[model samples]
Target: MSEHGGDRARAEAWLGQDPDPETRAELRALLDDPAALADRFGAKLEFGTAGLRGELGAGPNRMNRVTVMRAAAGLASVLTSRDDLRESSGGVSVVIGYDARHKSDVFAEDSAAVLTGAGVTVHLMPRPLPTPVLAYAVRHLGCAAGIMVTASHNPPRDNGYKVYWEDGAQIIPPLDQEISTAIDAVGRVDELPRGTDWRVLDEAVVEAYLRSLARLPLGTARDLTAAYTPLHGVGGAVLAQAFAWCGFPEPDVVAEQAAPDPDFPTVAFPNPEEPGAMDLALALGKGRDLVIANDPDADRCAVAAGGRMLTGDEVGGLLAEYVLRHTDGSDRLVATTIVSSSLLRAIAAEHGVRYAETLTGFKWIMKAGTDRDRLVYGYEEALGYSVGGDDGVPVHDKDGIGTALMVAAMAASAKESGGTLLDLLDDQARRYGLHATAQLSVRVEDLSVIADAMARLRESPPGELAGRTVTEVDDLAEGLDGLPPADVVRLRLSDGGRVIVRPSGTEPKLKCYLEVVVPVTSSPEEARTRATGDLTALREAVADALGL
Candidate 1:
């Protein structure tokens, strides 16, 4: 059969099997369009190291009810086989949560049904909630597994399913691969069992999550009058309540993006990292102490204070210092992703704490922390932070709501010290030297184009970047410092500048992260000029290497 014909056949089979008329009609519509069919059924959605994520549509390659059910079945199988999990939970149990994205609830339900049919007990959250809450629920409820349906900050058309183990962290290594194997074992959706015994989650579980937020160290309620925006995602209710629980004054909501809307009508993309995602919040926050925002799924956070929005690196730096100062001992360990700013390392070193750098994801950091009990905090450059120890507090996963509350507490404490967050940042720079980080992304319509660019750069590496000699080249794909292999390349410059080039695992773009360090005595004007010049040179070299 022709490729298009095969696609049509597959889509038609799905439509015929679908019980929902609405979904069947949508699938049929795609069947008639060659391009749509190819996009939908070109391949089965691969469960990568990051779990399952893709555009929502009626194809094997998409994140639809059928695909979600398959993933859940696979996860259930993995959970059932684990002796430790079975003994703890009595039976294999999985907690599922979802966001307000299109079809997210339906997908979550589908996963629950699949797990139920597999003889695994299922607890479904009563309504859409933050990703962190689901992460917390996994450990709090003592379930064998957990699932969250969200695309996080991806575009409106996208959705995802992330699986977490009993520890409330995203599945890592052997488990991820084992689940993928089980998912691949089932050849047809009809082969899976169907059941209806999945239970709606207990109200107490969610209540407990809220109660935990109340214990964070906010100094006083009077010092926190802030602005908040959920970016038309699922964070509003949980985050607002968390702030209130922490004794923070009610925040002024950005009316436009206050509610959970799958379409994300007010923003181009539901990501706080995107330009203009915080415009409404910034406008509404004019006179407030700070502006806090969460992405679609509420797993990441962004903060703006004193009329300036801080980058993820800036926030990470501040949080790292705050957590360190709060700790009494010097034996703490601080961890960050390799792509993040190295200023945290300087702070750790100054405090006589150990600093560790993981590969690019929070999963690695979480695992590293689990292996070492000394870990106090871990953060990535993408606005994800795990405060306290990996096994403590809300969850091991990245949590925006919890982090925001902590920020409020820090702000309140800073006020008591007769200074501001900016003042603390300045002090950090004075002690650690000045470290500034920036990233440049090159977008492309076709993913293969990015693959070609990576191939070209690897075949012929650049000798210099931004007029600085490349002092060393570390091909992460070959393994670095006893770490697992990853698809990344790091270029160390002769000056205290470095560049990291890697393709985004979850998106269709190439990312270039640049970090430059200047003496603390240098004026801000001089430091910025030097960084900009270095960035421009690096950009040119990247373009040349990619032949773009």
Candidate 2:
């Protein structure tokens, strides 16, 4: 048989046992089209960085019922295999949560059935909620693990399933591999045992999470007007209620993008970092004091304050300054990704705080914080932040709702004290050399393009950025600074200029992080001007090296 013919035969056999009527019908329709069939059944999806995320469709390569079932059973196998869990009377408990994305609820229910049938204790969230809520419940419920059915800020056509260890952080390294091996061992869906017995959690979990948000405020929250948009996500209603409970004025909401809509009709991309994603909120905040936005799953936060949208780095600096000033940040461990601006390290050093740099993603950043009070803050360049995650299980991940509330309180206090988030940023720049950051991301249809680019750069590394000879090239693949090996390159140029390039873990894009910090020799304004120019030049040089 031809390769395509073999694909058809395997797909037909698989379809005979597929329990989902939707997917079975979809496969049947594609049987007449060999190319579509080949594309769907070409290869099974490999769970990679950020768990099992892919376009939603009817084949193994896509996010469908069969793939998710195997993933759930795989995770269940790992959970039940633990000696401690198996010894327990009730076995290990697993909390499951879902966001208001396409088929997210279905996937969550599917996971519950598989885990329960596997004799694992399963508790499903009462309804669709943010991903962080699920992360918090893992430890809050004394469960051995947690599973969240969400694609986060991915496009409308995509969905994902992520497994979190007892630490409340996503599974990393050898464990993900173990789960993948178990998934490969899954038998036919019709033959698998799927019990209907499972627990649907009450509102106590949600209420307990609110108590943590309530403690996030430090200074006085004065009269402040704000606009909030969840970008047609699940964060709106809960955030509004939290604001009401926290004694803040009702925010002006972007009605069009306020509801939970899986279609995401309002924005091209559901992420606030994307251009035009915050347009509605900005327009609504034209005369307000602040504008806040959360992505689809609400695990990330984005804020526009004092009429200017703040970058994740700037927010990181301000939040660091705030948390440190309020608590003993000196003894605490604050962390940001290596690709993020170095301004944070300067801020930490100036205040006598211990700072650490991890590889991109919260899985690495979450480890930066140790005890509840000792290790305090974690953030990434991409709008992910964890302010109150010091306490275990409750918040082991980045949370948009809590961060947004904190931003509102910060804005109010700033307004009362005659300062803005933008002013605070300028102050930070003046204190710790004017640090400027920018990014250049290239999206591609074929992921091999990214792999080829990284390989080429590794083989023939660039020696300079914007005519400045690089002082050092830290090939992250070899694991420098006691960190896990990652496919990244860090180039240190003359002055405090730096450039780091890596393929994005979640998307099919090659991302480059650029930064240049110039001393405030004469004036802060002058330093900003020079640093911006240097960053622009740095981007061009890196783009040229990448052959973009």
Candidate 3:
């Protein structure tokens, strides 16, 4: 048989066994169309550290009932095989949550049934909720595992299944590899188990998460109006409830993108970081004290205040200062991704706290916190943040809802003192020179192309970037600063700026993070323009080096 023929055969076989008539019919329709079949069955959907995520279709390469069931069965098998997990709980317990994506609820139910059939306990969220709520439930319910059915800012046709360990963070290294191996071992869709008691999750889990967020030492609450947008995702209602409970004025909602919609009609991508994602919110939010936006699943947040969208670095720096000041100089540490600006390190030093940098994912942040007993707060350049000690009740995963509430509290307190978030930021800049950060992403058609680019760069790295001498180059894969090996390269520049480049593990893109810190003067606007110009030059040099 030809490669395409074999793929069709496999897909047809799975569809033949699928119990859902609708799914089966969908598969049959695709099978008759050569182009559709080729696209659907081109390859098996990869189970990476982020688990399965792609457009939904009737092939192994897409997210569908069969693929979701297979991933659940694999997770069940891996959990059962683990001595620690099996001994702690006679059968594994998994809490599943879904968003407003197409078939998200169906996929969540499918995962529950498969796990239940494997003799595991299944708790399903009763309604569509943010991904962080599910992460909180895993720890609150004392479950051994968790799964969130979401695509999180991807286009309408895409969906995803993200797995989490009991700790509430995305699965890392060995566990991810083990789950992938188990998933690959399943030869047929029928190999998965079926039918077990799946109950709706209890309501207390959500309340517990909110209570935890309220524990942050907010100096004082003051009346401050704000605007919020969920980007047509699943975060609106619950986040509103959180703000209300925390004593902040109800936020003005961006009507167009207020409700959950799989189609995400208003934005090209549902992500708040996208260029125009917050345009609607900004348009509706004139004269507001703040504007807060959460990604589809609410695991990340972006804030706009004082007619400016705060960069993730600026947000991290402000949050670090708030947490450290509230803690009153205790031995706590602030953690950030390596690609993030080093402004936090300077802030930490002034506050007499430690600052550590991990790889460019929350997984690394969680692991770093777990290893050190002093993880007060953690953040990434991608708008993900985790507040609370590592040993806290909430899981280590980022929670945008939680972060929003914290920010509101901080904002309210600042309002009482006649200050703004920007004021706090300016103080930090004055204390620790002005640090400006920016990122450039080069999307590609294939993952292998990125790997090839990395290999080529390693073979012969450029001696200079943007006409500045390269002071030093460090291969992160060789263990930098006692950290684990990662596929990244850092270049220190003669102008005291730095550039870090790495292929995104979860997406088909190569990302470049550039940062330059210059001394602040009376004319802050001039400094910002100069720093931005330098960053633009660095981006061009990186593009040239990659031949993009």
Q: What local distance difference test score does each model get? A: 0.81, 0.85, 0.83
> Per-residue alpha-carbon lDDT of model 1 for 1-548, expressed as tens digits?
98989888888888765656666778876667888788777777889667998887776788787788778888887878878767763788889999988888898888888889988999999999999999989988888778999888988888999988887888878778899999987656677787898889766877898887665444453576689998998889888777666667778889888889888899887788888888999999897778899888888989988888888888999888877766655456788888999888888877788888888887788776444456677889898987762224456778898888878777777777876676666676667766878887888899888888777767777788767778888888878986788888888887777888889876678998888776667665466576677667677777777777
- Could you arrange the candidates by TM-score from highest to lowest? 2, 3, 1
What's every prediction's RMSD, in angstroms? 2.3, 1.9, 2.1
- Name the better of 1 and 3 by lDDT: 3
Clashing residue pairs for model 1: none
Q: Any runs in candidate 1 off by more than 4 Å, and if so which?
A: 86-89, 219-222, 389-393, 445-460, 522-526
Q: Itemize residue pairs with steric clashes in candidate 2.
A: 372-390
Considering every candidate listed, which one attains the maximal TM-score?
2
How far is 53's C-alpha from truth in model 1 (Å)? 1.5
Global local distance difference test of model 2:
0.85
* Backbone atom clashes (below 3 Å) for every candidate: 0, 1, 0
Predicted structure 3: clash tally: 0
The candidate with the higher lDDT, 2 or 3, is 2
Residue 479 displacement in candidate 2 (angstroms)? 1.0
**lDDT per residue (tens digit) for residues 1-548 in model 2:** 99889889988987988778888888898887889988888887897547798889888889988889888888888888899989988679999999998899999998899889999889999999998899889988889889899999999999998889888898888888888899989888777789899999998888888887777644676589989999999998788877887888878889999889999998999999999999989999998888999999999999997677889988888888877776653457788999988988887887787888998888988877445436677889888888853342238789898788777777788888887778877788778888789998999999888888888888888877787888888888989987899999988878777889899876689999998888887888788788788888888888889887
lDDT of 3 by residue, 27-91 (tens): 88777676777777777888988888998877777888888988998999998887887777346
